[model samples]
Target: MTVPTPQAPRHVRAVAVQPHWSARDFTTPDAFRRWMRAQLEMARPHLRPGGVNLVVLTELNGLPLVLRGGGWALRLRTFERVALALFLARLPRALPVLLRERVSPIRALQLADIDANTELYLRTCRELARESGVYLCCGSAPMPRYARQGTVLRRAPGVLTNQTVLLDPQGNLIGVTDKVHLTPDEEAGGVDLTPGDLNELRVFPTPAGDLGVAISLDAFRADVIGSLAAQGCTVLLQPDANGAPWTSQEGLPPDPARVRDQPVAWLESSWQVTAQRQIPYAVNPMVVGNLLDLTFDGQSAITGPAEQAPSLRSYVLTDPRPGFLALAPWVTEGTPDELRQAGLDRAAHSGHPLENEYREDTLHADLTLPPATRPAPPRTPHEDALDALLRGEARAPRPGTWRAALPALPLLALPLLALALLRRRP
Candidate 1:
């Protein structure tokens, strides 16, 4: 017995967005809903005519707003930090409230609040899809939902894996893909995410064609990308939560070539996945806005098939600003079967473009990736501060200043005081 070959739509119009989202956006659920609505409105004219509009978003992006909606515990835990002593002191009080967040009447009530807001946004997306007459991937934002005993999986004690939701042209759910690879850095920040079942990696049928969703760092793995290609995923939906500065080289005299290569435009032009014999088209959206001193770089991008990667005209590096980058919108062509087959063939050999480990994997595994040898960019002040927080250390600033002398005063006097005490005793 043989399976039928899957097909791709003749045309696809994918849109990647990197809008302004901040700590302020997490103030209220309604505020966030409205912001998403506004973004859809902004992308209105750019959407393809009767084609797939691939929309991506940051991973677990709506979480802060949801947590804040819970009133005190999460809000205090997230935004307002007390001293180490004070934080530990409140654990008795904070602990119960946190546990309660996942249980009982409180869970139901909060879900009602969050779910209602989410539904409102989905309704808006559906209406927009109906009105605009285009397929919408609708950015993937996670909800800390409660699932009752059901067909999906055995009943759990609330809290499930992060799921990426997509809205069809008529405002209906086309697919729900749970994120497979959760970022370790995110887990360190107190959000304990569960990985999805590997079976969920299968492509979902869409009006545009076979759609596969990979969240954030999942795309960093060559094995993961290979798996999707093997499963006949014609188009890739990569929603990212990258906070790395696109233009981190702030102080040092910069290289013109490096600056030119750092934009969404550069990725769109160079990252033709079809040339690598993977998917014919891909849309990747990045999260923007600063939260708790962490400033996100907005470099959302789009890519398609090319004969070969084009060497572009190099321009002088001035202040290269980052914002919503767009490629000349066009329709996607070609069936994904050949593209996917070619990818599988390359993975079988080690001909993958990324030089990434070309192999199949389970939903979870330790992937050995090559070390990054890219040029290091200078850290911004905010970046340096964030780096300190991550390292869990503090240092005295400006060694030559008087402020620095204050900490060293006791050390300087220690030997002198010891000698004086010894002489007096003699």
Candidate 2:
């Protein structure tokens, strides 16, 4: 008798999971590895050709304990000071420990933490990128010294302490962008550091596409979103560690108000202008909790050029089924002229809506362009002086006097001191 052969399972499209939990919650490294393996098991069936598995590792605060073992407990009180000293003293040793512990099956990972841990966190991420074929990205900011009530002292200051970085499979730095805006207290000098410029924006080139990520809580601003959209940023990841009031209110926490409002604004603004909508992810809580309890509020979607109508897609994990959010495969293309036109349109529209008087003026301004041709003129002495200034040459009132003062001051000081000493002898 002949037996029938079983057919192999059909392959499905791949989806990325943004699990908002920490890797260190697992007691042992092996347990963490098992958790990662299990995640892969759940996602494997859906893995498809050219698909990406992106996981945002939330709640990485316990990383120090996970990598250093129970030994970290002894220095818990002075963890910041000790961790800094240890990291500076033995970065060579610490880097390997971090890579071995944090495990995930995702093609890319984003880790968020407080500012003090930025150095050690990035170093470990760099090492992990080398060993694993996954890309790693980090986001951080200086801790706030004062809470809403009063003065609070955050230990780490403006020390390159808070940052988000991406690491390629080879562990080389692919992209790095600093957090632009800070929380109210952070900007108030509660942490002893100056806030970074909110205007600094960057887009990273990835196999997936040109991923434009903004490192600011206020990235939800309409102007910022419009600007990034104009610049061709499709994926906007907002990794926020703002817990307590933002996540919960009166002991009952639903989705955050800001989180919900921002993504909606991004969708509406991008859709109206260019049709290139953004996929916005809000990685919140920044700690370990019941996956079932945690809710991803914003829409997980993809948008195309203005010519294509917007399609709204949302992925909500109501239960622990362990599925992924599948995105339509992306292909790189030339910079869309529509994006530039949309940007210009937005800028022209952003002026005071109440000011009807400037309507004609604004229209005229938008339509005008500078002349393409100009005549070259001879350079005058004043022009030469201005040119020298532009080139970064010193423009002192008396060039020689200022230049000679440095060496002359020391010689003058010694004689003055000697004369004073001689006079004091009486």
Candidate 3:
């Protein structure tokens, strides 16, 4: 076995894939193969001889093998959770499993799928990496923490975890970054994912430069991105999945203006990290016509460095629909440890950052969708309550404050009563 050596950062092309989705994509195992094949074909041309291919979040959830119909309310989010609880309620051979696992039935079934097909995704990624000759960031999916068995990766049963696996050109597993944040939809029944240690960020050696990987909300976090850049990463790959909300425009509402345009949090988050860190950040989000009740739609893009205040102004490769590869036009030119030695990390404290000076002013990619009004993301119950309270649609004061006001209300009224008595006497 030969030890891989670091190469000087050269100009390279990177593609972010926006996967195509449909009910078939998640309905059966066979559909998964078909959908994934299409995705590979779209990404093949952009893989280039040496570069990166980023597949966005929950790529495997597309295999909704168990839950089918009912969009957000009926199937994907709520009812499926209830279904999980019911399925586990009467299982005869699950006492030991219960001790080690607390994931939903949906999550459990997905894990089972992985166990039955050990090393399937990993092997596929290895093949893709070797064939494409570019580093591949195989975004997230549900599985137990992996342990290799011979040439296969065997996952222990009931060990719940999901990760972003990185593959080199030779099909080697160089890094694994697990997800960092969970929306309320994921933790509905008081269950959540095992968060990866932010400190354990893997920096893969490549001619393209030292690359770091972040999953979903991990890219949004200031500390996380800065720490990776501080660790000397020239580029960051973030695979995200925050679905498009249910914005029903049927039978148009009397006040269409009430429907606010919702900007994607992860997209906006990508802009902040790229411009601030002065590094190329590739982000890919999952998109679908509609899943059961969930509607997933968004673009995939590479948000790289720029010189002006609008740092990512023209340096963005955005693919909003019909899955395509988002690529950068020019290769980044830099030395070994170019990003680390730049001392741009110190700029977080000072007002100046060194990396922003190098800009890719020329546009490189052609795959794109014109900008449109993004619907507001669906709010969690907590968010809904907060919004209602703020808008005076609900009155839910704290128990302590309400209780405190009870006695005070009567006491305050006594002054009014006394004043009325005095005025009558006068």
Best candidate according to TM-score: 3
lDDT of 2: 0.32
TM-score of 1: 0.56
Find the candidate with the highest lDDT and give its number: 1
- Candidate 3, TM-score vs. the true structure? 0.58
Backbone collision count in every prediction? 1, 7, 11
- Per-residue C-alpha lDDT of model 2 across residues 1-426, encoded as one tens digit per residue: 999665432221212322333324333444444443443343344333343323223222323322233334333323233333333333233322223323110100111122223333444444444444444443333321211111212222212213455445555555544555554433322222244444555555444334444443545456555555555553454444332211112221263443332323333322232232343222221221221112122222222332322333422211111112222211111243442232223221223332111110000000011121222223333223322322234231210112322343344453443333233210
Error at 354, model 3, angstroms: 47
Give per-residue CA lDDT, model 1, range 1-426, as digits (tens): 999665432455566655656555655556676766666665676665554555554465654544443333333332323112222343333323323334322222223234444444445556666666656666655444333222121123334356676656655556566677776543423344456666546666655657777776666556567777777766677776655343333232365445332333333321434336576556666665545434454345555444322333111122222221233211111343443333233221234452211211001001111222222233333223322322233221211123433453454553553333222210
Q: For model 2, name the residue pairs that clash.
A: 59-286, 130-171, 138-164, 138-165, 139-164, 145-152, 145-190
Candidate 3 per-residue lDDT, tens place, 1-426, comes to 999665433555556666545554544445555665565566666544433333333343423433322123233233334344323432222222332354443444344344433234555556666666666666666545544333333334455544676666676555565565554444423223455566665555555446676666667676677777676666666665544431212121586555432232334466656656544544444433344334443334566544312332222122232212243231232442442333232212223543222222111132111122223223333333322332334443211112422443445553453333222210
Could you tell me which 10 consecutive residues in candidate 3 have the lowest summed lDDT? 361-370
Candidate 1 at 240: error in angstroms? Answer: 1.2
- Candidate 1: the clashing residue pairs are 126-171
Better of 1 and 3 by lDDT: 1
* Model 1 / residue 373 / CA error / Å: 41
